[model samples]
Target: MIEILNPTLLARARETGALVADILDTLRSRCAAGTNLLDIDRWAKALIVEAGAVSCYVDYAPSFGRGPFGHYICTGVNDAVLHGRPYDYTLADGDLLTLDLAVSKDGVAADAAISFLVGDARDAESVALIETTERALAAGIAAARPGARVGDISHAIGTVLGEAGYAINTDFGGHGIGSTMHQDPHVPNAGRPGRGYTLRPGLLLALEPWVMADTAQLVTDADGWTLRSATGCRTAHSEHTIAITDDGAEILTLPRRAREL
Candidate 1:
């Protein structure tokens, strides 16, 4: 289902988006060597509850996933990329970690993700992968304007990833989000411009650009939720929720500090 937020709901969306961004930023700062993934989930739950918000993940049972997600946040480590279920794993120095989160507040929802290294040992390949995804995400956001087709955003994102020498995966990508975590108008990472659903004011979209270091294939972990690189290569993911407006796309999920000034 695709939802176009009215002004009031859009205001709530901004609040929810800021909350999601703040939580992710806090989690990223708290993560370090020896940090347990479960601890991250716990921290996320505590914050969400304190804010009187609802987790879009926990109790989520989608056709693509096994059962209820049962976690407050997604913890993707090293080879893990999407739908990473929190486990007993402790982060190690230089470990690439991706944290994806979505939540609803005031009857509105926003989703975002971030990828970073665990410690000081940032491998060259890992740094490059993370940077590429960030750039692709930026490109996608830049293309999200009223009247632009979803394909324009996808094409912009794909251009960056393809030029960076990473294969693109279309199975799972960005999608319309509002009131709910995932919605209609599936936004692939790559597509031809001037195609797909046209953008309009009040439309909300979660634009995510993710890539594996070597291949485009993915393998599901034994947990039935975590998606890892088929070749076990390191991966990175970056995402943000944006609202299309008359001027352009307004990024609702920017960090609180960034939004403040």
Candidate 2:
């Protein structure tokens, strides 16, 4: 559904977004070589509960995924990209990790994701993958405003990934988010400009830009959830929830510390 959040609901949304961002930031700081993916999940649960918020994923049951995600956060390691169900795996130095989180507080929801390397390991390719996604996310956000169309944001994001020589995957992308984690007006990573739904004040959208190093194809893991690159190439994803306003798009999911600064 396309929801134009009212001021009261929007205020609640800001609270939820800050909580999601803070939790993600805390979890990122805890990840390192020897860290367990399951531990990350536990940390997410603790943070969400402590904030009096609930996960949008744990009980998320969609036709594409195994019913009831049963995990507080998605842990995508190296080849894993989307819907990566947390498992018993130890992160190694230089492992590329992607943490995707969504939560609801006071009946409002926010979603965001971040990709980073573990410990002191940083390969050129891995660094490129992560940087490209972040740039694409910024480009997408820059294209978002009261008068622009969703396609404008998609085109902006796709331009960055395309120029970076990464293959774009359309199977899953960003979408409208508001009281719920996922909503209508599907925002693909790549699309033609001047198309799709026109933006308006009070609209909330989660703009995500993700890419695989070599191919656009994806293979699901045996767990029936985690999506990995078909060529075993490293991947990266970046996302944020933004609210349309009179001036422009206001990023709702930036870390509380970042917002303060």
Candidate 3:
């Protein structure tokens, strides 16, 4: 459903967005080599409870996924990209990790994702992939404004990824978010400009730009949740929840520390 939130609801949205961003920042700082993915999930759960928020992942059963995500966060490492269910794996130095999180506070939902490398093991290719996704995310956010079509955002994201020489995957992408986690208006990583749903004030969109190093194809892991690159290439993802306003797009999911700066 396309929801144009009311003023009070929008305020609640801000709160939810802040929580999501704060939790992601904390997790990023805490994750390192020797850290178990399951520990990260547990840490996320504690943070969510401490904030009095609800997890959009646990008990989430969708047709595409094995019912009931049963976790607090998605942990995508190296080849894993989307819907990566937390497991027993411990992060290694230089491992590329992507953490995707969504939560609801005061009845409003916010979603965001970040990709980064672990420890001091920084592979140039991994760094490039992460940087590319971040740049693509910025481009997509720049294209989001009142009256702009969703295609415009898609095109902006596509242009960045395309120029970086990464193949685009359309199987899963960004979506609308409000009282619920995933909503209407699927924003692909690539699309034709001047087409698709037109943006409007008060509209909230979670625009994510993700890419695999070599191919656009994906393969589901035996765990029934992790989505990995079909060619076993490294991947990266970046995302944020944005609200269309009169001036432009306000990125609600930007970290509070960043906002303070």
Leading candidate by lDDT: 1
Per-prediction TM-score: 0.99, 0.99, 0.99
Model 3, position 242: C-alpha lDDT score: 94
lDDT of 3 at 213: 93
Runs off by more than 4 Å, candidate 2: none
Tens-place lDDT digits, model 2, residues 1-261: 899999999999999999999999999999999999999999999999998999999999999987899999999999999999999999999999999999999988999999999999668999999999999999999999998999999999999999999878887999999988999999999999999999999999999999999999999999999999999999999999999998989999999899988
Candidate 1: tens digits of C-alpha lDDT, residues 104-150: 99889999999999989968999999999999999999999999999
* Candidate 1 positional error at 173, Å: 0.3
Model 1, residue 198: what's the lDDT?
89
Candidate 2's displacement at residue 76, Å, is 0.2
lDDT of 2 at 261: 89
In model 2, pairs of residues that clash are none
